[model samples]
Target chain A: MQIQQLSVFVENKPGRLAEITEVLAAANIDIRAISVADTSDFGILRVIVDKPKEAIETLKEHGMTVSLTNVIAVGVSDHPGEFSRAVRLLADTGFDMEYMYAFISRDKGRAYVIIRTNNGQKAAETLQENGFDILSPETIYNM
Target chain B: MERYYQPEVECASREQILAWQNERLVKQVRHVWDNVPYYRKKMEEKGLTPQDIQGVNDLKKLPFLTKDDLREAYPYGLLARPLADCVRIQSTSGTTGRRVVAFYTQHDIDLWEDCCARAIVAAGGTREDVCHVCYGYGLFTGGPGLNGGSHKVGCLTLPMSSGNTERQIQFLIDLEATILCCTPSYAAYLAESIHERGLRDKIKLKAGIFGAEAWTEEMRQNIQEKLGIKAYDIYGLTETSGPGVSFECSAQTGMHINEDHFIAEIIDPETGEVLPDGEKGELVFTSITKEAFPLLRYRTRDICVLNREPCPCGRTHVKMSKPMGRSDDMLVIKGVNVFPSQIETVLLNLGMDPNYQMIVERKNNLDTLEVQVEVNETLFSDTVRNLEKIEKTIAGALQSVLGIGAKVTLMEPKSIQRSEGKAKRVIDKRNLF
Candidate 1:
């Protein structure tokens, strides 16, 4: 299963992140999980939110560069080897990953890692066949 | 004490100067009509012969020449003299466009050197002075122009072209060069280098004759203060003899246009109507004296004003103020003429969206260009590396097309401002005006 992640273009400036967060707060959009890939000049803000469609609209209205990217969310047991095993499976299968960020669930011994790979469909299938729970968009949005 | 290279002409009265212009204009008109078929055809279509253009007053009756005309008659189409008589050629820095090349005979070079000599003498040059010329040699005219002028003035000329700052400073200090000639930006860079090496006091530069690029009055003041010299502005283009047509005197009001050799006019850019003296408009020049590549009523596309106000320097020549703006969409980046259309061609050829903005800035006395393109769905990617790769690809393409590197910035969609259904193409932060 693939979930829609909001990717934002962020120029390196003071209070830019704060401005984006303030916009999300005003629109009552709760950011479920977020990861920032940064360089000295600029940064890319990848976010999973409660309402993907509304978040994209609000950010676009605020003049923010926002795009929807398809990323697979894999649920794994909250253990050190569990996270490594899923990535090792993808690596062994020669599936390249752009980036990945994790968020722990409320339930004990459980976590979801967002994986952005070259082929989302094939990677999700590979992870699903390898004894991993492929989390759906609705399940992640309600988390 | 005040000095002039040629007192007879530089200090000539209005009547004598008018007499010279009247005679030269008539002769030059006939010379062009007889030799340059390209311009002669235009004159024939207008149903005019050389006799109709009797003096400077009838100058406007002739058709105007622009860069397009120069390009059309490139290499030898507009040569009034035979190739055997031609001695050299100088060119403008135009990349991806037809390079404007001007031919010169021995006589033309002599007169051009005289113009430059007048500039040097006006800047307090003397035979005892060591003229350190760093204005770039080769086809570009700045170095050779000043080198010839310094020699005519009898100053010990150093033909050191631009760059190699360490050696430039060494020569400046050891030889104690009195006159420094280069672009205003290079002059500023030299000042910084001298200070950074803690050798400011060792520099004996008394005056700097800077040209070939646009600069602000504040930049002049800064360079003057740092180098401990008076910075004078010299104006010229390759189409018209190069870097010596006009020069600033100690009077510091404006540059006196060597009015005896060239006639300067201000015309409304849109209507082509001649504007009165002291009015700002596009500058036009008609070379009455250039033998090989004489341009008649050539439109310079530079926005400036001509002033006949009496100067304290005692030169009777009319002075032209510094060019304030351009009549068209051309940007002078690091002394290179960059047209927005040229940039557009590169982007379109590379399958990029036509919407882009050119940002010109002056950082550390150097010109920097940044091209900002709006991101479309096809251009953007979720991965930063891929997006950055696109930027690098565009930058490389621009470098090869423009012969200069530019920073490529990918802006968001619908971000570039549009006016009247057209995007504002250029945002110049140089503040040259």
Candidate 2:
């Protein structure tokens, strides 16, 4: 129950995001969810695309430093206090989350949150054990 | 290995050396006063004449010559000899304003080569030894000085002027070059390259004479272990003829100045007050024998102490410690001189803010220059690809200006530390012992 995410090292400059998206669009690789972690000098653009391998290869060919990271995608109820419970469960189980971003699924009345943890497998197992729906690569990529 | 190059001179008595200096200095002062009108004005403004300078002790009475004086004098103002009489010119790598050119007569060239020959001999060089000179030729003094010295010593001289590491190593192995002459940094680079190629045992180098820039004892040890050779430090400047002003003997304590031709002095850089021996201060050199571009009481701006202690190598010449620091902000990167003002000028001309930091480090035995510049909001908001392009543009501009490549890192505005009094511009992390 892990999804492959593309992490790109990007210098903090104008039109860089557009260029990356342009490359992905040109390659017909659909980005499902995207978030950027920024520092003063540079940024790490984390992207979940439909074809992770293709996206990585295309970006690498353009001389970009891209890495494939395994992250757990958790399906949570799109309601108040529901996301907090899942976060609390992970916290109680000593699963330290590096970063996380959420996007609601259009078909179902549920929200899917992508989380990068220190240990992805252990976090996925812990979430599943606590009766939360853990997303598989196929499900996340398809969504 | 034999120590002194000219025994009567290198191991000359203090009284004898002083007498030679007194006579030569008096003659040189008079020569400059009669020939160089620019220096004559400086002496005239101070209400002094050549007659006022009787000996080395009266050197302080003479007007001090600095880099500014050299710049103001420019091409011909400081030439103490007729243009037709001078044979050559060696210049400082002018990364800043104007290049300071020092003319050399045929006799001057002979003396300069003789000084370099003394350096080689002091480093155990002989006629049987093949001297490989990799210092850049042309206007730069390092290569020509050593090449001529190698010929003077009867060494089969290899005039491989800088760069082309593979070819240099191939020649080193094929020719069995025993004495290597180049900048200390280049020596380190060659040593690293040789080790990386696994050609340690195939080489036959026994000693290296490194100069043209500042190096530490730690760097010396590091290069020595890698190259399996004793690295000797040499000291010189274009103003005082090239490498051979002073040289380190087998004792390796400090470089002994060629007192027969040049007189070394220590002075408080602020007040110009002469300091006694063993006191660390600004080094001053008075060329008693230079003819074409003779300078009196030329301020070197190098901070070091002079020792009059008898050397184990039997050279009675006064020894000067390796330059501890510079009184100015001049930096030597990869043996090329760089000033922070030069970098600032490049940045401002490009419409960028002058807030920047230069980081110098020795990686893989080669000096790496990284320029971290603060990016404006517009640049920071640009695409990563565009930002990278800008970085490359800035790097290219710096390279064109500096004559050396620098890695340009675009940083956020206000990220660099700002100071109220003096801005901390350079961070040199090369641990020098």
Candidate 3:
């Protein structure tokens, strides 16, 4: 399963992050998880919100740079070896992972690995076929 | 290697370029004298004939044609050929009365598109690339000019003429558009849109050709950083031709005119004396190959400099910097000449947003200029006092920098209409023409 993530193009400045959050708060869109990938000139503010469509429209109406993307969100055991085993499997399957990060789930003993890979659909299919539980937008947004 | 659609012949050594121009100039003069009634009568009024005009150097002997001349001539009166020979017409839209139109025969259109093709090639476009034409279609020269040129280069074209930013993003991502052509302001808007849609990394656009409105180096840098693409400046007017009259190459210093089809001149607007290279003055152009309406020495009123040095791209045709101001658009306030570009420079230098709309009106016989600038939400916290402070600070800055009193209004971000085509930055309602 692939989760829909919102990536906002934010000019790197002091209060840009706060401004974006303010818009989301006013729209009542709950942010489940967030991370910012940044360079000196700009940043991609990635967000998983309860209402992706509402959050995007609200941010856009407020003049914030935003984009939507499909990313693989895989459930993993909280134990240390979980991430390595998943990576090893994907590597064995010839899937190249661009970048990935982890977010702790509200549910105990489970963590989610948010990954950007070259082939998201095929990776999701293979992960599902191999008994790895793939999280959908509904699960990611709620978490 | 940098591209050149045709070997530049205009900058060929003094003897050869002029000799070639003289031959064509003689033919153009005879054509005008025989076909166009306006030029024929104007020449006759000065007690001159085609025989009196011998060469390109004698261009000054001919009267200068301005936009007003086009308006006076109206639709097809100035056309040198019959309607059957004219293949297309392109017009410029101004807030002032009656838009100025230019005619192009099949040959003229081909030459114009060739000039556009050369501009694209200079900016690193190729047949394998996909071109996204975002310039507004119909009544604007930018869309079709680039469209025809991209087709000539065998590039897949996306004629996505202005507005509907969502669809623009979709096509840019889906088609992997490589080359983008549009006004600079629209490019900035598109950059904002792509980033918001999370499609910045998905876009394959390598270069953007921006023109039609005046933009600053700061704006160019802003767009380039946002979109991760090279930004090139282009210059043209409907009076001469559309967007490919001149363009920026990899050097990015200035726009190189396609002198093989258009003759470029720089003249002092007031004294009318032809200025030397590097002297900032009004730009004038003569259409050498336009058959339907071959305008001779048409004054463009754009203030800029012409560079003759060979660019790294290897085109010898002279290059012109982005126009500093227009002679007719310059405002005389308290006897000090002020152009909108100067205000833009000050606004950008202060680290303020450039989404400003200027209002010039006369109050009690004194000219008053009010600048309404939209505050960037990311920079300004939502507070009335903060907005007031910004307004006061901008007013003080403008007062000191321009040496004139101005009222500054800080507006909500995105409240100012984002321009989809050419940015209309000035609104002189007082001059109600």
User: What lDDT tens digits, residue by residue, belong to model 2 across residues B296-397?
Assistant: 888998999999999888888999999988888888888778888888998888888887899999887688999988765434432345566778888999
Instruction: Give the runs in model 2 whose Cα sits over 4 Å from its true position.
Output: A1-41, A44-143, B1-3, B96-98, B378-381
Q: In what order do the candidates fall by DockQ, top score first?
A: 1, 2, 3
Q: Model 1 reaches what TM-score against the true structure?
A: 0.91
Q: Which ten residues in a row have the lowest lDDT in candidate 1 chain B?
A: B373-382
User: Per-candidate DockQ versus the true complex?
Assistant: 0.36, 0.04, 0.03
Strongest candidate by DockQ: 1
Clashing pairs in 1: none
Candidate ordering by TM-score (highest first)? 1, 2, 3
Scoring the B chain of model 2 against the true B chain gives a TM-score of 0.96
- In candidate 3, stretches whose alpha carbon ends up further than 4 angstroms from where it belongs are A1-143, B8-15, B330-433
lDDT order of candidates, best first? 1, 2, 3
User: What is the Cα-based lDDT of residue B417 in candidate 2?
Assistant: 65
Flag the better candidate by lDDT, 2 or 3. 2
- Please give the distance, in angstroms, between residue B351's alpha carbon in candidate 1 and its true position after superposition: 1.6
What tens-digit string does per-residue lDDT give for candidate 1 at B21-113? 999999999999999999999999999999999899999999999999888887789999999999899888786365888999999999999
* Model 1 / residue B216 / CA error / Å: 3.2
Q: State chain A's TM-score for model 3.
A: 0.93
